[model samples]
Target: MPASLSVETAAPLASAADRLRQIAASTVRPDLLGRIDAASRTLADATVRVVVVGQFKQGKSSLVNALVAADVCPVDDIVATAVPTEVRWGQQVSAALVTTLTEDARTIRTPIAPDQLRRLVTERSGAPGAIGTLHAEVTLPRAALAGGLVLVDTPGVGRGNARAATNLTLLPDADAIVMVSDATQELTDPELRFLQQAAALCGRVTFVLSKHDLQHQWRSIHDADREHLADADVDARIIPTSAFLHSVALRDQTPGSRERSGIDQLAAHLQGPVRADVVTQRQLAAAEEIVAVGRLLAMVAQSELDVLLDPASGGVVVHDLERAQKTAEQLTQRSARWQQTLADGVEELIADVDFDLRDRLRKVGREAERLIDSSDPGRSWEQIGAWLADSVTQAVSDNFVWAHERSLHLAGVVADHFSLDGRAALPELSLAGTDQALRAVGGLDFIGSGRLGIGKKLMIGLKGSYGGVLMFGLMTSLAGMALVNPLSLAAGLVVGTFAYRQDAQTRLDGRRAEAKAAVRRLIDEAIFQVGKEARDRSISSKRVLREHFVGVGESFKQSLAESVRLAKRGADMPKPERQLRVERLTADLAELRALCEQAASFSTAHASVALRSAS
Candidate 1:
């Protein structure tokens, strides 16, 4: 179950926002009005998405069902999930299947009964219309989901499975990922690798050991899994759960059973710590917006106050504002240093990202060839193939993470160029779309069958032995009395054994070489495909940053121009009217000060909360 922001936390932020909103309305200042309104709307509409992913038949769907206390995601023993299902809060229970038709390739979403979910989201034998289903959306009126906690149940990761690639696409948007595994065993190497990758991508990962009731040694396994996490340096909390126990607890109203199930603790942790992070981030963002608006508001009020207090000073104030206005207006100009910094940074970033990806893929190729040389690919080809795919996936993911970080760094550099005071809020860069960019690249295709069948091996052995027998046995027969004598037969037999061994070695060598070539091809293809998409995304990011900062600059210019107008107008008023205007300005400044204090206070409270949680 997902947790919503606590009422205690939400109340104060909402109160501060309401105050800010009233001020926006009263001031009728366009800059303050729009920023406040947008911040408030973003806060109200914020949702935290927690995506659950795991290997096949790991009870991922069951865990989701238990959390929501509803069968929103279909589960079965044999068939596994083939599509992602999103479970979020709704007033009524409803489900829809999203699919794309083959002919027109147009996406169509159709409403379906909850019971139809099992058929619609499963493999092969699924319902007729579920053929091209992309994903399923399920909504319920569960209290756990009411707080904007969206639970996405994704297809499991499995060997040579297309679902693994599909699951990778969801990593970008996930606020958190719950990697589910059953209590039957500790985390496997692949699962541990995935946890590392998930942590890198989403920054928040929770490992859940499910089916706790069935495994007597699950507790021991849980401890072992913790050790594995420590060894891998993957910071994730592993919770052991029993969906069976959860279901029973729900039916029997047994608190003890629920407690033992660990579901309650899982829910609390998500709602408390996990949900707190999301809320805190939003709180701080809204606060920043509110504080910025406050500053702008106070600026307007202060300029008018100066004009109202001293008519002689009004001209000086307006002149200063006009100068500031010119600088701000230049921020939006094409020749601005920030724009130049952004353009240069983007080009540099693109080159670095391309180089980084190529370097990574080259390493993957080398590792692939090394593995091929180390083992007989004929017997280990499938494992090698899976490893290659996973390795490439990892390399690509790491590259994307690096690119995302660099993009943020570039934004900061641009911000530094724009900020006169060396402090400016870097607008959020839209770098999460790299997942979509990678999604365009296909998974590695399986290379040649390394297995040379017994028949072919025997044939090669016989072909090689035919010449060996004639040469060795004839030479031996010359030393003996007859061609079919014991010495001749022994010579042929020994030669045949030698021929089989040599032929087998030759075949193994050929397969290894073939495997190496295929792996290199795959790596090259990945680099080309992934590199192009990454550059495209980089260009897109550049455009977004350019537009965003330009807008910010324009806003600043507008605010300054308006402030100048207010000061000039105030200077022309009569003495009595000037006094009244000063009083009004004084009151607005006081309100703005209070709002800013509230923002600071909220940040302090959350900071303390975070510290305590960490401790």
Candidate 2:
């Protein structure tokens, strides 16, 4: 996207497909051409989402605007982004507001004036059309976005903030992440932790230090930041930039200023590693499909050509293909090794994930009990309740992250037995949006003020002691003794003291019991809600793998059967006509082999070369 890096850097992917399409058209089978066209469309429509996240007022929006060289995202002095703003490619500058009445409701996209973005995206009360606003979106005709690179500007993140959780949700869908921080200081603990998380979720995380022009000591800060990253074990490239300079460069049309702004270099990384990686992945996937089709067609042509050249050997050729067809058929069976592995893996995952959730909750429950013991639940319930909620939320989040990752590992295991490439397109498991599942756990119903008060305790004590005094006084008077005797008076005093102690102890024990029960109930509900969510996601992933691998097996079986049919048909031809057919078959086989080689080349070597060249 920089002036130095030509737009032609993005052209290789399209060019490769064009060359392949020409060859595919020459093939006799209609399905071959259709497959290549569909792949090309998928590649063309693919968008690389680069999510930008950072602490509040770190110039995140400014970095986004500078990267695209457009005032798409609104910048502010005091307030920060409240909702995500997605800036992507369009023929003309346009903005839209995405809204929904509730989390589960369908989204509505309404067009808005470009200038209205600031009011909608920033923290503003009573702004028109701001109610139920989910996120803001803008599109421009900037060349930086021409290759389907989308820039997401997210709300600032802080420790334990829901905004941070929201940012985590974005990482699963992001192709790359840019973490913005100003050069006023080195990395903070929270920022380091966030970087580690972003790296795990999306490996293409780049650290960008904004406001470089304002910090005279930025180089020292950069050095310290690198060391902090090394100590934290977060892998990211740190780039320093001055968004102010970039804005000035654009206004003055000065390339030198733009280069000094460091925006150009950052843009190059996106255009190079970030955009190029997306292209490479799509290209490899398309190549895999092409090669598979080519191999099948070549098999049919080669078999038919064998029969045409040697008419007497037609029977043997058909027999060999029939044998191969049976082998392919076995792959489609329920008893296949891959199918068995998938079933076992899913079962193991369900049990393990449930246990993991319970273990995490058990630890949280113990910690809650400790807090309750340290202070009276009646007075400190507010603080304790907040702590409990945050702790449980964290445990649930960590458990889900583990489940999602394990599911991916299981998919790779199945791919080993199913695919010749020994790889799988990472299954699109719906791992994000756990807010609903988390809410399903409900809240604890512990009445912290449930214990008896002083007035009630006094009343209960009097009632019990009064009965004891009346019975003892009557007994003493029946013995012709005055009720005011020392024996009677002593007995009355002891009963009253005993009654008061018993009542107080009972109330205190009951409150503790009630609090413990509530804690247990909360933990149980969390286990049920989050555990069920994990299992559902696991089932969805299993179904995807089952459908994909079974389809591949079926294709193989069909191709082999077609090869057998072609061989038999060629054998029945007259000798004179067979001679003419052999020549055409031979040429087609050679062409198919050549195409397979080209596809293989694209799948393996071209991607890394593109990265290096773009750099």
Q: Tell me, by lDDT, which candidate is best.
A: 1
Clashing pairs in 2: none
> TM-scores across all candidates?
0.86, 0.76
Q: For residues 202-310, what per-residue lDDT tens digits would candidate 1 score against the true structure?
A: 7788899999899998889999999998999988888889888999999999999999998888887776678767766777777777777777767777888888888
**lDDT score for residue 287 of model 2:** 69
**Each prediction's Cα lDDT score?**
0.78, 0.76
Off by over 4 Å in 1: 1-12, 22-31, 45-48, 98-108, 125-133, 158-175, 201-204, 231-235, 251-255, 418-423, 429-493, 612-615
Q: Scored by Cα lDDT, where does model 1 land?
A: 0.78
Q: After superposition, how far is residue 64 of candidate 1 from its true place, in Å?
A: 1.1
lDDT of 2: 0.76
